[model samples]
Target chain A: MKIIKNLALGVSFIMSTQLVSAASTGTTLETVSPEADRIALQNFYKKRFPNTELQDYVNGIYAVDADSRTQWEDIEAFPPYEFDVEEGERLFNIAFANGKGYADCFENGGIGIRQNFPYWNKEEGTVKTLEQEINECRESNGEKALKWGKGPIAQISAYMAWTSRGKVFDISIPDGDKKALAAYLDGKKFFYSKRGQLNLSCANCHVQGSNIRIRADLASPALGHTSHFPVFRSKWGELGTLHRRYKGCHQDSRSNPLDMQSETFRNLEFFQTYMSNGLVVNGPGSRK
Target chain B: MRKLTTSMCVTGLVALLATSPASALTVEESIAEGKAVYMGKSRGNCISCHQINDPDANLPGNQGPPMFAMAQRFPDKRILRAQVWDATKNNPISIMPPLGKHWILSEEDIDAVVEYIYQF
Candidate 1:
C-alpha cells in the first residue's frame, strides 16, 4: 500500500514538472489529469465524512454538519427563498422593450440550462458564466444590463436554477483545445494560489478548514461549492449570486475583489463548477 | 546632559529619519495601528483566521488556534514574530502565510502586530 502511494506521488511529481514546462512552451499542460483531480477531491471529502453519501454532497455544508442540517431541514420545509424564487420567475419571463425575452437568446429557451454554464466559449477563447450570459441576453435585446451580484441577477438566476433543479452540473473542459485547457488551468491556479493581505486561498477555508466552525457557522467544503447559486443570505438580507459570495469572501480575506463575472472570477466559476460537475443544482438556497 | 541629548535627538532632519515612523507610538496607539492592519477590510485582517481577545471584535473566525496566552506560548517574543514571519518554517503545509517572507507586512507594521499580539 505504501509502495502504491509512493508511486502515485512520483507520478504526480513527474506530471507537475511536465505541466510547468508545457505552460512555458504554451503547449498543452497535462499536469495530472482532470479525472485524477476530480477523484482526489471527491475522495478527500468522502474520507473526511464517511457517513455522507456521495450524491448528498450537493447540499454543501449541510451534507456533513448534523447540527446545521437539522436547522437547515426545518428551514427547507418552508424555505425563506420561496418568495425570491417566485420573484425570479416573474423577472425572468418579463419581455424587454424590444419585444424580446431571455428565451430568445439561449438554447432550449434557457430553461433547465443553468448546469451547462461557465462554459469555455471556444470561439471567444474565454470562460463564460451564467451571469455574464444573462447580461449578454439583456444587451442583445437592446436593454440595459443588470448588476451581476445582488439584486436582479440573483433573482433571475435563482428562478433559472429552480427550474433546473435536480439537473446535475455538466460543466465541460472541452477536448483538443489547448487554450480552453489553459483557461481551466488558470482557473485552477486562481483557486489554489494564496492572495490578499491575509494570504489565504479559497482552499484554505473551504478545503483545509472543512467542518471547522467560524464564529457561529461552519465553513462549507469546496466539493459542491458551486452547486448552490443565488443563495438567500441572512447576512445580506437579500438574494446574492455566487460572484457576490466570492466578492464577500475576497473582502473577508482582505483581497481586492474583481468585478462580477470578471475574467478571473469567470475562470474561478469554471474551475469550481468543474469540481462540482456531478452534483445536482440546488440553488436559490438560504443561508444564515 | 540626558535632557540635552533628548532635545537634541528631537531637533534636526538627521535625527528625524531615525524616528521617522511618526515618533515613538504610545503602547495604546501601537496596539491600535496593529489592530487596524489586522482588521482593515482590505488588509491583514487576522480576525478572518484566528480569534483574538478584543472586547469590540465580532468574534470573526476560528480556523487557527485562538490568540490567547501568547506570552505563555512563546516566552521569547522573537519566536512569536518568527512564527508569523513564516509559519511554513515550522510546518511545510501550514495555511498561515509568511507575512514577512512575502512582504505582506512592513517591518514597522509587523513590530506593531507583534507588540499587540504579545500583550494578549
Candidate 2:
C-alpha cells in the first residue's frame, strides 16, 4: 500500500494547495454548452451596461462612451472607410480569365452574405472565415489568392460586410455536431484564457474592463465586440481586417499571436461571431 | 540482506527528494528565468500591460502603471505575491489577471515573475 499512500498524499496536497480553475486547459477541454454560454454572455453585458440598448451595440464603444460618441458620429457621417467600400465593390465585381467572378462562388450572387460567414464547415471539419472563402473563390476561378492581412482582402471583405448592413449576425453551430460544438467551446476558452506576459485574455479588457478606464480609453463589452470587422483605424490611416486586429491585440498583450487564418483564429472568429449573434453588422467602421 | 537493500534504496531516494527543492536554483538563476518570462512573447508577456525600466522591453504598454520602484511600494514580498496571486481580491473590477489563481503561471513561475518585477 506504499503506492496508495503516496497517491493519497498527493491528492491531499492538491486539496490543501490552491487549486486553479480547470476550464483554461489548452487540450482536453469539454465543449461548453453554447446556448447556456450565449445566454450568460447576454446577461453579463445587460448587467454591466444597464442603460444601453441591445441594438445600440452595433455602434461599439460609442453605445457606452457618450463623450466619444459625438466624434464617432462625425466620423461615421463622413466615414473614412467609404473609399475602401467603393474599391471593395469594384474588386468584388471583377472576373477572371475563366469568365467567372466572386459572385459565381457564393449564394445569392454573393450579396448580403456577410453574417453567414465564420461558419462551421463540417466537410472541412474547421471553421471557415470570409477571408478564406474569398481566397478560395479566387483560386477556384484561376486567380491568385489575395494577401490576408490587408489591402485587397480587407477591401473585398469591406464591400461584403457593407452589403450586409443591418443583417443581424446569424452564426451557428450545426445541430448534433460535436466537433463543431467542440470548436465553439475551444474558441470560448481562448477568449477567456489568459495569455501574454501581461497574462490577459480578450475578456480581461472587453468583458471585465467595460466602462473601466485604461489610460483614457473605455473598453468595449465582449458581447457584441465582433459585429464590426474590416474596420478602418485612423491610427493606421488604412483599412484592416479582423485578423489584423486579432494579431495587434495579441502582440499588445505580449502574446505570440497565431498566424492570420490559423485554426485557432478561425475558431476564435467562429466563437466571437456566434457571441455577436443578433447584433447588426456595421463594418467598414471608423475607429480611433 | 534483501530487506537491508530495499531500505538503502529507499533512503537514497528520500535523500535525493529532500535535496531537490533546496538545490533547485540560485537567486541569479531565478532572476534570469524571470527576465525570460517577462520578455518572452509566449510567457508572462509583462510588456503587454506594464512598462519596465529594462532596455530589452520594446513598445511597452501604457495601459497599466509603470513598473517602477516596486520593492519600495510593497517592501514585503507577501504584499506583492498577493497582488500577483489575484489582484481582483483587492479590487473586484481590476483588469489584471490572477497569474497564480488562473493557472496562467505555476507557483515557481509566479515567484520568478515577482522576483523579476522587484528588480525593476
Candidate 3:
C-alpha cells in the first residue's frame, strides 16, 4: 500500500511542480467531510505503529522512539516549564488599564479551554487561535499586545494549556458556512503543497516520514502535533508558542516563515487540531 | 570557411558546458568529496534517511531504502543524478530533499555524490 501511494504521488508530482493535491491518494479534502479526514489519519497512524496508543501521540516523537521516551521521562520528572506556568498564572490575573483582566475576555475565566481554540469565528469570518485571542484580549483591555511567537505570550499559553491537560480536542467547523470550509481546505492544501527551494510539503516529513531520522532528530508525526505546544525546547532554552516551532520548520526547509497568527497559519491550526480531535491535550511540555 | 569555424566554436562551447565538475578531479578525490557531502549533516545528509553498504557509515537511518546495489537499481547514471537532484520528480511523497533543485548542494557537489553513489 505504501508502494502504491508512492506511485500515485510520483504521478501527481509529474503533473505539477506545485499544488500536488491529495486527490491522487483519494484522501482529497475536496469533500466537506472533515470527520472522514480525521478518521483516515487516525487509522493511518494506528496501522503504522500498532503499539502506539492514540493518547500517546501527544508526546510527539517520544511516542515512537523508546530511547527518546526514556530521556523525556527523566526530563519530565523535574519539568523545566514549571516557572513559566507560574509566571503565566501571575500574568493572567494582573488587572489591565481598564481594571479588567484576561479572565473578562474569555468563558470559564479563560481556564481549561485550550482544546477548543483555533475555532471558526462565523461573525469574524476567520479562525482565531489561542495565541491570537490572547493578544486580542490584551488589546481589547487597553493592554499592549504581547509578541506572537515567544516570551510572555508563550508563557501565558503554557499556563492555559496546563490547566486543560487531559481534555481531548473537540474542534468543529460550521457545516453551512462555505467560508469555514474554504479556510479548512486552504489549510489542507497548505499541508500537501510543496513549497520553498526544498520542494517539501508538511506531509513529506510529518505525515509520510514520521519517526524517520533526519540527522540526529526524528520527524514527528502530524497526529497530535497540535496537542503539545508552548514547548520548552532545549534548543531554544526557553518556552515558545506553536507558531514559533512552525516558523523554525519553515526555515529548516529553506522557506521564509510566515507571520505568526496569519490566516494561513490559523487555518492550518484548525485543520491539524481538528484532526487530533480524540487526542488529549498535554502542553507546556519539555523536549530535547 | 566562416560557417565551419562558427560550428566548431559552438561545439567547443557545448563540450565545455557539458563537462562535469568531477572530470577535473582524480577518481579517488571525487569519491572522497562525494562521501563528505553524503555524510555531512548540513549537506546532502543522505545517511540521515538512508543506509549504505559502507561499514564506516555511522548510524545510518532506515527511513529510506538502503543505498546499496545502486549500479543495478539505476542502470543509467543520469537517472541516478535526477533522483539525487530531486527524488520528488519520481515520488512526490518522498521526503528526500531536492539537493540540486534546491541548491542545497552545488552542481559540483551533486556530480561528485552521483559518481560515488553510482559505484554502490
User: In model 2 chain B, which range of ten residues has the least summed lDDT?
Assistant: B15-24
How are the candidates ranked when ordered by lDDT, highest leading?
3, 2, 1
Task: State which candidate has the highest lDDT.
Answer: 3
The numbered model that scores best in DockQ is 3
Worst 10 residues of 1 chain A by lDDT: A6-15
All candidates: CA RMSD in angstroms? 10.1, 9.3, 6.7
lDDT of 1 by residue, A1-288 (tens): 332222111112222321211123222376535666677778878878899987888788999999999998888898888888888888989999999998898889889988888798988999988888889999988889998888888888898899889998888777777788777777778787778866678877787777876555688888887888889887888789999898888776668887777888888888888888888998878877
Docking quality tier of candidate 1? incorrect
lDDT of 1 by residue, B1-120 (tens): 656654543443244334433427886888888888777645566776677888866857766677778877754455566777777565543566678888888877776787777777
lDDT (10s digit) by residue, model 2, range A185-204: 78887887777755668877
lDDT tens digits, residue span B9-116, model 2? 466456544542232667688878888877776677667667788988787654456677776665445456667777756544345666788777778877777778
Which candidate do you rate higher for TM-score, 1 or 3? 3
| Residue B86, candidate 2: C-alpha displacement in angstroms | 7.5
* Model 1 misplaced regions, further than 4 Å: A1-28, B1-61, B66-75, B97-120
Better of 2 and 3 by DockQ: 3
Pick by TM-score: which candidate is best? 3
Q: Can you give the lDDT of residue A276 in candidate 1?
A: 80
